[model samples]
Target: MTDSWLPTLLTETSEEGYALAVRLSRTAVKLTQPSAEVRERVRADYAEDFGALIAISHVVATNFHTVAAANGFWRS
Candidate 1:
């Protein structure tokens, strides 16, 4: 298991950047929750929540936006 993460969000492609964004959110959860058991316990809380899912998407989109800007909108 990787104990540490986050060495700049620089990614070579938009797909990779989007993946990183999701990873960033998951990492934040791990850092905050730290307990896998607790996280699992609350999984159902938002498992079928439409608003929660949208919020998650917003967070990922925001991170991807920054990455896209850094990559000059992926223009050639």
Candidate 2:
């Protein structure tokens, strides 16, 4: 995980954060596409990448909530 997006995610509006999270999720999927070598190296490398990708998904969901709240779209 790079520090690059951390500040933007923290400071930008929820909409921006949601966009960024979606982009990150796509990128992470591309990275983890299973090649033979990649499968062999999962313990050494791909596991962390996969974990981070899951974390990004969580962030995306959180941002969705934020956007909904900002727009007064929340349910009781």
Name the candidate that leads on lDDT.
1
Predicted candidate 2 versus true structure: per-residue lDDT over 13-73, tens digit per residue: 5456566557655545556774656546654564568786687668667666655565455
- Per-residue lDDT tens digits of candidate 1, residues 29-60? 89899999999999999999999999989988
Say which candidate scores most in TM-score. Answer: 1
Candidate 2 worst ten-residue window by lDDT: 5-14
**Which residue pairs of candidate 2 clash?**
none
Q: Please list the C-alpha lDDT of all candidates, in the order they appear.
A: 0.85, 0.57
TM-score of each: 0.83, 0.35
lDDT of 1 at 71: 74
Give the residue spans of candidate 1 off by over 4 A. 1-4
